[model samples]
Target: MRKITAGFFHSVDGVVESPNLWQFDAFDDELGALLGETMSKIDTVLLGRVGFEEWAGYWPNAEADQDFAQFINNMPKYVASRTRSQADLSIWQNSTLIEGDVIEFARELKAREGGEIAVMGGISLARQLFFAGLLEELTLITHPVVAGKGKRMFEATDPVTRLELKRSSTTSKGNVVSVYGLKPE
Candidate 1:
């Protein structure tokens, strides 16, 4: 079975939104290596509607040497969106709008042969996949800063989900890189 993983650049205060706004100062070689390692294993990319729209606008036109530009731009992207149709995804190349149940589509995708399905930065989509038991791994690079305000990864009302820490390390810049697997029910 193909492994499904979601990675987030999170803050100490739990904010996962727009890490670029607050995370660049703390970015270092260690973080870059960590991200490269993660990208090495992933072939498919999954995105939520918001993330899809946001990324489609920028990554396509990004300079050739820009980080992740070539990889993300050329790789097949499956976007999970309830409101978007197939016609709407033409703005970006190699993007397919998932039809019907997102969870079911993911399951089918997992069953097929692939390298890895990566959930890039879709908070809502990642939460849904993680809670639905579709995501096999969750990796977080927690920077040593408190973003005063932004959308968080989890809500208080969300059902409790347990994770087993597969591995962890602190970067030179005080960023904590942690990899977790869902605890067996």
Candidate 2:
């Protein structure tokens, strides 16, 4: 079965929104290599409506020399959105719209033969997947700075989820990349 791995850029305070504002200075070649490695392992991308719209607007026009841009443009993308129609998703090449139960779709995707499915962004979608127990692994690239106000990666909730730390490494630029495997219930 293909593993669903969700990767997010987070702040010290657990903020996951707008990492570009604080993550630039902390981004180094080491971190870039790590991100590239992660991208190489995933042939499919899972995104939410917001992430799809934002990326579709820019990534398609991005320079061909940019490795990440090229990867995103070429990979098969599946966007989970109840509001977006097929026409909306077709704007991005190699993109598909997922309208029904996301968990069921994820299950079917995992059952298929593939390299890996990477959830690039979309905090709400990631949270939903985490709660549904569909995510097999999660990689949090935590920057050292603390963003005082932003959408947190994890919210206050009733039942807590447990994760086992698989590996962790720090880049020279102070980005702590931590990989976690979802613990069995």
Candidate 3:
């Protein structure tokens, strides 16, 4: 079975939205290497509606030399959007509109033979998969700064998701890198 993984750029105060606004200054060589390694193993991408719209607008036109352009552009992208039609997804190459339940699609995809599947930039979708027990692992590259206000990854009413820390490390610039495995309930 293929592993479903998601990597989030997090803050000390638990913010997850718009990491580029706060995380650029903190990005270091080690972080670059880590991200490169993660991208290397992922052959499929899973995204939510918002992420699909946002990325589809830019990534396709991104320069070939851009770090992630080639990989993300060419990967098989499965988008979960209740509102988007096949025509909307046709704007980007290799993008497919998920026809039914996202969780069920993920379950079937994981059981299929493939390389790693990475959930890209969809906090809502990632949360759903995480709570539904479809996500096998999560990597958090936590920066030292506290984002004053923004949407967070977890909320009060969310189900308690247990994560077993598989490995952790701190970068020279104070970013905390941690990989966690989902613990079955």
Best by TM-score: 1
Cα error, residue 143 of model 2, in Å, equals: 0.6
Clashing pairs in 1: none
What lDDT score belongs to each candidate, Candidate 1 first?
0.91, 0.86, 0.90
lDDT of 2 by residue, 80-185 (tens): 9989998988888999998689999999999999899988767888888877888878889899998878888787872676889999999998889999877866
Lowest summed lDDT over 10 consecutive residues: which window, candidate 2? 153-162
Question: Lowest summed-lDDT stretch of 10 residues in model 3?
Answer: 62-71
* Candidate No. with top lDDT: 1
What is the lDDT for 180 in model 1?
A: 91
Better of 1 and 3 by TM-score: 1
Tens-digit lDDT string for candidate 1 (1-185): 99999989999999999998988789899988888888889999999999999998888899754769988988899999888998899999999998889999999999999899999859999999999999988888899999989999899999877889999999999999889988976
State the displacement of the C-alpha of residue 175, model 2, in Å, after optimal TM-score superposition.
1.2
What lDDT would candidate 2 get against the real structure? 0.86
* Model 2: residues with Cα > 4 Å off, grouped in runs: none
* Rank by lDDT (best first): 1, 3, 2
What residue runs in model 1 are displaced by over 4 Å at the alpha carbon?
64-67
Give the alpha carbon lDDT tens digit for every residue of 1-185 in model 3. Answer: 99999989999998998897788689888998998989889989999999999999999998754878888889999999999998999999999988899999999999898899999979999999988888888888899898888889889998766789989999999999988888655
**What lDDT score goes with residue 96 in model 2?**
92
